[model samples]
Target: MYHIRASILFCGITFVFNFVRADYLTIKEERSYADPPTGDWVTNGVITPLDQEMRNFYIRNADGVIEVLLNEDVQIGLQTRVQRGGFEERKVEFTIGGKRFSYDLPKNLYVKRMFKDAEAVRKWEERGRRPIMDGKLYLKPIADHLPTPEQPWISGKFIRENGRFIDVQIGREIFQIGTQGHDGQHRFMGLLGQKDIKPFIQQAFVHGKLRGDVFHASELCLRMLEDSKAQDDPKLGRYLFIGDSISGNYDKALRTALKGKLNIYHPPTNCGPVRKGVENIAVVRRMTNRGLVGM
Candidate 1:
């Protein structure tokens, strides 16, 4: 029943800043329901260029633009990989400029796809639409070093177990999951915790590497369970809109634009106008009635 989660991150606002430059640093705060009416996360973002390097970037908040810098390494192209999936490709690919780039090391990559193109997705639709993940998902890390992806399969929540605050029976254990392929530098960043991890004893995952009789936990994924919805927090809101071909034409773009924050659902067939709506709406209504989706 444990679902995977993600590490802390946030949304961005666009603007050009003359002073201070870096790649990314944005903070967003939500209603901390755990802390109730008065509980709100106050945030300020700061990014330092590590030993690896630095880049010119702009930061922002509700008021205006903010940028912080640390190191002297602006990648000639882009540091993060831009993965692309399409009809022609059998697997999703990172937009590695040319075949030659520095720091090209092996990475853990996991993706639930048979291929990258529309045809592959269409073929999948013919089936049950279940997840079509690659076989070697999170088996182990290629590099046996500290801060490896697979080593930190850890998370937990505290409950009164026997007599102590042992989270033997806790919520989702699937935080910070990832995968890697042997052939390429492609890595898959699966799930991450919503917040920065705390100490191992309290709100973090209380597990570790199997060495002798001791457990060694280098990093931990932190989580706060919701009362009504168990440990899972549905971050995005799903909305259904019925319309003609116009809506259908822009459907993909709309979804792409609002990728992570919200999801927009539509019927299989376009509902068209009022008279058309009457017929198609019934199908949609049946779908909704059966707990498929809602308005």
Candidate 2:
């Protein structure tokens, strides 16, 4: 038995990738959180749910399954394992696949990054392969660009010094970036009251149209929603959530989980542990504005 090992230097660190061929051939890759300098991949198959609880599922090619899971770091997006308990199973075709991708694949954002169908695998085999590397802050340009887009859209260091946005630098350009995540909910009745991003470096996709030094993306569920005040949506009617600490306790989460479907508001009067919560119901009604709710 023989193992071939290759080392790549990225950013400032070194990474070792080993290719072992024998009984069962497999490609194992390990690298920093950042993705490609540039490129993409195309795969064909229908993603099937395996175990909703474990966040496990897979794409089927010929027979069995290559069970996959949603990256724990990712909480939102089409690749999310978070069960909607959908009314019906969807026939989806590679939401992130069938397109170009770069080396800076965000495991958090591209939850299905590892999946490759037979045709895609064949393409990989035909194009060729490379070993893994280390230090995501730096990446060497690809000699032969696979998955098209021969040139990297951008390459540089990304850091979240603080707050919800990341500090990014690509060439002479310096930008603060934030990924657009899950859609929020609207709490109608009683409204009122609502993270630092992870830092990395070297090569990654900047989803949004660039503006000054900040990158804002629209739909890639990879952010944490904090607490603050609630605003009603004129499109949807408002909803009043009345309860004690239990209801109040889960109010924020309920709003997030709802994906901003309803305008949810917890009456300030019933927001905490009150000695006489039920009695406060009347107080809440009296406190709120006119015709806001029918409580």
Which candidate's lDDT is highest?
2
lDDT of 2 at 47: 34
Off by over 4 Å in 2: 1-149, 161-164, 183-295
Q: What is the TM-score of each candidate against the true structure?
A: 0.19, 0.19
TM accuracy, model 1:
0.19
lDDT of each: 0.26, 0.28
- Candidate 2 at 15: error in angstroms? 56
lDDT by residue (29-131, candidate 2, tens digit) is 2211122321221111223334545243333222222233333332222221111211123211222212322122221110011212345434544655322
